[model samples]
Target chain A: MEKFRANLMLCAGTGCVASGSAKVHAALRDEIKKRGLEDELKIVLTGCNGYCAEGPVMAVYPDEIFYQKLTVEDVPTLVEEHFLKGRPYQKLMFKEPEKKTAIPLMKDIPFFKHQVLRVLRNKGLIDPEKIEEYIARDGYLAAAKALTEMTSEDIIKVIKDSGVRGRGGAGFPTGMKWEFASKVKSDIKFMLCNGDEGDPGAFMDRSVMEADPHSVIEGMIIGAKAIGAHHGFIYVRAEYPLAVQRLQLAIDQATEAGLLGKNILDTGFDFVLEIYLGAGAFVCGEETALMRSIEGKRGMPRPRPPFPAVKGLWDKPSVLNNVETLAQISPIILNGAGWYRSLGTEKSAGTKVFALTGAISNVGLVEVPMGIPLRTIIYDIGGGPKKGRTFKAVQLGGPSGGCIPESLLDIPVTYEDIQATGAIVGSGGMVVMDDNTCMVGTAKFFLEFTADESCGKCVPCRVGTKILLDILTDITEGKGKESDIETLEDLARDILASSLCGLGQTAPNPILTTIKYFRDEYESHIVHKWCKAGVCRDLTTFWIDEKMCKACGACLRACPSKAIVGEKKVPHKIIQELCVNCRTCYDTCKFNSIRILPAGFEGDPYEFLGIGAAAATTGEKKGDA
Target chain B: MPRLTIEDLKKIKEKHRADFTLREGGYRAKVTVHMGTCGIAAGARNVMTALMDEITKANLTDVIITTSGCAGLCAREPLATVEIMDQPPVKYCDLNDDKMRVIFKEHIMGGTPVEKYGLVVGSETTY
Candidate 1:
């Protein structure tokens, strides 16, 4: 293929595909071909760009120009004007939401301004299907070094110097794990890549595998060499079909090209790789459980006196690393320990990729160096909370992690820094929550997930989680007493202490952390009988303002319980007894007649409005979704 | 498809570093046309085409022209930025074919620097 002058790189990640980037890609290709500019201008379909909120994103080559939300309709015009006429397309650019100004450059955008990409270095830039592209960008250099030149001791020493920890929620040193596995003196040791990313809002691992599968492969290869393992397995969750498919293809391609399988690079050393499909159990994310699942068992965690490093998969000494951890290996090996250490803090040397989501304007995958403050991620990278809402707190580390309230937003993002706030930086799932989010409801939601996902091997997780979830549910439904909080704390402590695996052991973290930080929200639920965020529908009553009720029967007709009663062209009333608080009346009220009387609401719901009870009830809040 | 030797990996990285790496000096100047939804509506494609035409006409082999996302200033759509190596990127807002030509010749080739239509005085923009 001849070298192209200008390349239009379009995002082919899942989010962008759902948003019609595929059509835009096809249109751009057709337009380029039609204009006979295919020789000079080429189109490359890449993986997820971090700012998914402004997806279907693309960028031009060499010049490094970023574009968002490209539609097929804009392709002809874009080709005509930009490719043929040399005029910038203003309509297709991102406009600042608050400033109402159309900013065409990425540098001016807050979303991409602060991020320092390392693990996600090739994401959204390189075509993942092409192996040459991966190699062309120093992809396998680290693996070659580990295989041909560096001994197992040297590689482990370099990793130790780099200060990278396991990014799978637990911050264990990679070098120590490798050292333990290497010293085990086992002939049939194994290397495993834990790609079973089951966190609700986490997609960093998935994107890494999808966008740069070779990096992970190389990392695993280097790890196998360091640990004296000849065979490796990547346990990816079944839900991520795209990642799995891409990874399988990469494995095949590497094997064909001598990047994998026997005698890689003809270095007189051998390593074989395979993919193990996970059964989509959340507990399988645990290292031992993942190994058990690979061994054709029920994917339950066995107690560890014999951790994977000493005796693991198939009762052989094994080394298991997170998908993100393994991906960093290639870079650290190629760039020296000092180069890796230069990017992040002293203790945590390297960048972290976070699936930045919820209650924020720019929700996408973000990678930042360690020791960067949460304030920078929220305000600088996330563009703060969505419109008109105050930033309340952010949920980090998925279910096993804790919540960080607004007061701790200034804390630096590191393992130690996160632990200081009683939160684990687990899997780098930073879910920003607004003031409108009820802490009680949030904890209950996570408890429900853990309760349902708890493996029945241990009694603490299996039984304790259900009881805790039942209590949280009753609290949200306004059926809790002051003693329930104490009970919840006690039960949560028991679950954390007695649980057999990480899933059960850390299952109570969200509840414990929320109770620790937002105990007032819990006190309000049990004592005041109110949910401040109005998220607990059961704790709030929906009423109709007598004056604002345009006599419209929209609410009355739509009420499933017949709770609303009003005649056409007159005022309406809500029968509180029949009101189940399904939010049907509130959602159906077209004239803004419905008002919520929160539990323990002292003053009249209308009194807070302070208007003639009609228009005051309906000051259409442009609440950011 | 033989196994890549250590020397092959180094050679490939050297060949592709300029494209993937953020550092400059591989190209003379980088011109970016904002191509978000608003930029496309405001004729950024035309601005890009005009810049490309001028670069081709001038026989400038080193200039790299590309497109970018929203400039945060929506009222001023069709944004264009001209960046020279080691210099700050100058964002030129509200452009057309005529303005693009002047930008191509004077700002890009002449290196005289244009500020009237620009937003930021280039400090830390991408290479």
Candidate 2:
């Protein structure tokens, strides 16, 4: 970057690609060539820039000026003004949403300001396709050090001291996992890197594999040496074709550079890496299930005790770690364990990458330190939901993890702390829910996903989830009774206790947590047959309150069902049978005049408010500290 | 390529270290052209040609030039940020051939920024 006057880093990751980064790239190349400034200016296509919403993103090196939401048409003028004149592109910098004023530098933006980039160190900085760019950033230097200077014993101890746990949902200590495999006396033990990121809202693993393929390669080679294994495979989801493609390219580059394959680094340690793609099964994320899939068997979780560390990947002593956990290896090995320990809390050391999305202003990936509070992530980092709507809860761990209510936002993010709040940091997918989201509806959605993806290896997950979903569907559709609540709680506990594998064991999390926190919402559904957010269409009805109605005629115009009957500047009445429970009028009414009433409301609709407006007081009682 | 040794790895790192030297006596001057679509639309290519022609005409080997993606301020698309060693980066905005030529001759070569075209002096960008 310093050798060249400046470098144009164009984001080539998936988000930017969807937003037309390829056109931007071609336009840039053509523009640079036409100017004959090819030698003077270097154009490098980098990976995910993290600021995904306003992509295709680009940043000028040396000066570190940030630009986003670029299109092909903006190329010629950009090349002219920026390259010819030494000036700041004030219009292209990240604009503050409220002020609509551009923030020129990357560090000033709230999205990148809070993140401590260790795993994502190469994000938006280096061209992932070029091994040379990675090398220049000291990519495989850590692996070289481990092979030549440090012993296998030293590698394990440094990782142990660093306290980096498995980032693939389960927070098992990495050092301990490595130590177990290293001690095992086997001729052909394997180092398996799990890239099967199946969580619905999670994409951190995908970003890492796409952005820093060499880092994963370097980590695997080092892990292989430490565990006394010469053969390994990175089990990535078949759905992640780009990740698989990038890893293949990186493997070729590393092999060519003598960093992988007969990796002498002049040392006799010979380690080779390969890729095995799973058929996009969620259960394949489980270590044993992934191994079985690699072995050409059905991807389903088996019982533990003979955990993958003891017997894994073709019945050989092996070590399996997540893509993110492996990326952390090179940094820990290069910077030492103490440096890694400095960033996070005592228990949860190092940073966690989260795919922050759903009802949030900043829709992208964020890697924050483990000790940061949820309130900071939601408020400071995420900009506190989409403006006016209040923050309800954030679904932390997909179907396998539970939701954390607003009251517990003060709790620091750690494996133990998150678990205490009925959610595990399961691969860091923080889906922020708003006031409009129905608690029972949200729970049912996650349940439906697990029920669909349940490998069906055991009865608890296969049958238990089915039954729980049926009850939730009944509750939402106004066919439920009070007895169903206690019945669901009992059934969820039974499934947790008797389920054979992790899938079955964790299937009841969404239902259990929703009932635990939002009991009043569930109670409202059963007793009054009401849905507060109008999400449960069957139990809900819409009516315009005559007192508050400004007679704006907004509801009549906006109604998709055309059920509302009214004249200009007059209060409207919803024709009941034609209403179709659409709630279009409710959303369209600006005067807050339209309200939801239960379908069988015996009296005035004004008196019968939904559960969200009712006394729903079942979450954490303490104020955020 | 031959197998890499510890010495070879060190040499590679050293080369990179020198190439990416960021601070103090690191380099004489470095200029970045914002080339993201936003900049391109704002005529960054013309800026590149103008800057390149001037650099060649001046026969200046000390000054380095490069291109970057969008600086995000698409409104003032044509942008150039200059970094001189031991000094904060200066962003000169809405650059065209004439304004850039003057900046290159006076600010880049003579160490005096053209006040009118310079959007913000120093990289704090606090506002």
Candidate 3:
């Protein structure tokens, strides 16, 4: 093996690649070759480093210096200054939003510090394309241990003791599910891996598959051994071309290395694996629907008196585990169940990977312990909401999940705790929302998704979600009735009660949760005909408060419709008839001078409510008065 | 790549031990080659190249090689520092390729500070 003094682990994950890591990679290679430093300094294109918002990012090992937002133009300065002169380039180092000092090390950055990497242990450290690098990190040792040393009963017992639940949203105990399938006598059992990650704003599974493809493969080998299966299939969505390509490469590498195919590790354990591409249907993420899709049928759920553990994937007893759940299996098998049980709560042991997106400052992937508070993940790890915005709520579990209000921010992230607040810790997609986001519109946005993805397999989820989406649309557009709230609640409950599979059952969670927590926002839209957040255009009317306006002409210049009329030293006025309600003027004003009133309001907003102008723009509900 | 037996897995792990040590970190010693303008002008690049060759030749993965700026001693020209885990750092001054190779053998591999080449025992406080 060739040795280099320093390794530059450059991120080439899908996020960083889209942000132009490829150009930077080419530039680095060209510069390194020109300088004759290729022998001394090696460049390794590793997977996601998780701080994706700062791509294209690179971490220089041995020194452990972290550089973010690299462009090809900056590469010359970086290689010359840091790689040659040994002085780190200050321009690319990560600077905190308010602080002037740049954070140099990856471990010092809060986004990377608070995370505990178990499933992502090899992320950004080893090259995903190289099997040698994976083996160097003790990759297949666990599978070797499981196959050669441990019996099927022993593997099942160790996993049951670990208390790891499925990470595909349902939180079912993986060991119990494996035990069920292992106990049932069958001729040929199938070990299936669910990689059909359909949730919006979620990429945990895609990253795991792309970054550490071998870990997933190694995990499947151990799982196949545990369930006494001889064949397996990994069902990935077609949208993830990079993940699919990398996983296929890994599968081919493992097979050639004799780690995957017949007589693996010379222990006479044989297991074959294949990759099955999903058509990007949202419902295929469900276990039964995924099994049907693998069997080459239209992806829809069937009633489960006979679960997949009994009659799955061609009427054979099979064990289907999520990509994340399978990724964690090898680590538990290698380190023992007690090692896996060290971090999380007794009931929900081990860490979970979350894709932090939406209105947060740090949009990336993170793995936190199971029992940590949501406030830590949001405020500490995610850097809170974007600048100058107050946190309103965080939507968890995609469409099947609910929004958690600020009051429940301190709740521990255990499955039970989050479920008690009407949200499941499903697949760890946390979309942080700010004060500018309207709760009614937020519910409507998720309903639009679930309504489109209800699969039409069951009436309650199909027709009931459509009816709920229509009512939410009405509420956001200022056409809602007094009885509409009750109607939405009653209908959401009916869908929750009589839906088949996990899709329709939890589809109404967003509507139900928003009505439970932000009921005042709902009433303000339905009765007062006002969207204080100014998000619902039909219910929103933007106005300039004459007393607060500075006569700066900032709003006048920003208005696309040329609705604002003002001169030097004169407060601006918005022509109601000419205004487009685009909120451009509201956002452009430096001073807090813009006020939102109910649609078609024709009087002075302060005088109509008999309140001070100062209190009017703070999103207070003055309509009840 | 052929089918790897369990023994082959261990061999591959041993071969890549240094790469992982640089990343995941359990290094026994750290060597910092000063690469300031003055140091580079005074054959510091030769010393650095020598150090890299010796580390690779010896297959010492637990010993990390890094570079730092000038140590504020331009008179010394080329300088290097070796700090084993839990020990005070030792700085060697006025180094060349031959002197660096000797230092790698006696001090880095043998774990003894070469008294003739050594200039300082600990780092100066910046604050």
Scored by DockQ, the top model is 3
Q: Candidate 1: misplaced stretches above 4 Å? A: A544-580, A584-595, A599-603, A606-625, B14-127
Model 3 TM-score is 0.98
- Native contacts present in each candidate (fraction): 0.35, 0.36, 0.74
**TM-scores for all predictions:** 0.83, 0.86, 0.98
Candidate closest to the true structure, highest TM-score: 3
lDDT of 3 by residue, B84-103 (tens): 89889999999999999999
Clashing pairs in 3: none
| Runs of candidate 2 exceeding 4 Å displacement | A1-3, A546-554, A609-625, B14-127
> For model 3, what is the error of residue A282's alpha carbon versus the real structure, in angstroms, after optimal superposition?
0.6
lDDT of 1 by residue, A1-625 (tens): 2334576778888889889998888889899899877866867778787778888998766545667888899889888766654555667777778776667666677787788878988887788988877887778988888887899999999999999999998889999999999999977999999999998999999999988999999999999999999899999988988899999999999998788888888897788999999989999999888898999989889999888898899999998899999989988998888999998898877899999999998899999999899999988888899876799889999988889999999889999999878779999998999976899999998999999999898998998999999999999888888899899999999988888888988899999999999999998777767676767976775668887788868888888999877797779888878878788877677776776656634445555545564334354432211
Superior by TM-score: candidate 2 or candidate 3: 3
Better of 1 and 2 by TM-score: 2
- All models, RMSD in angstroms: 7.5, 6.8, 2.2
lDDT by residue for model 3 over A240-344, one digit each (tens)? 999999999999999999988799988999999999999999999998889989999988999896988999999899988888998888889888999999999
C-alpha DockQ for predicted model 1? 0.20
The CAPRI category of model 3 is medium
Give candidate 3's whole-model lDDT: 0.91
By DockQ rank, best first, the candidates go: 3, 2, 1
What are the chain B TM-scores of all models?
A: 0.75, 0.75, 0.95
TM-score of chain A, all candidates: 0.92, 0.95, 0.97
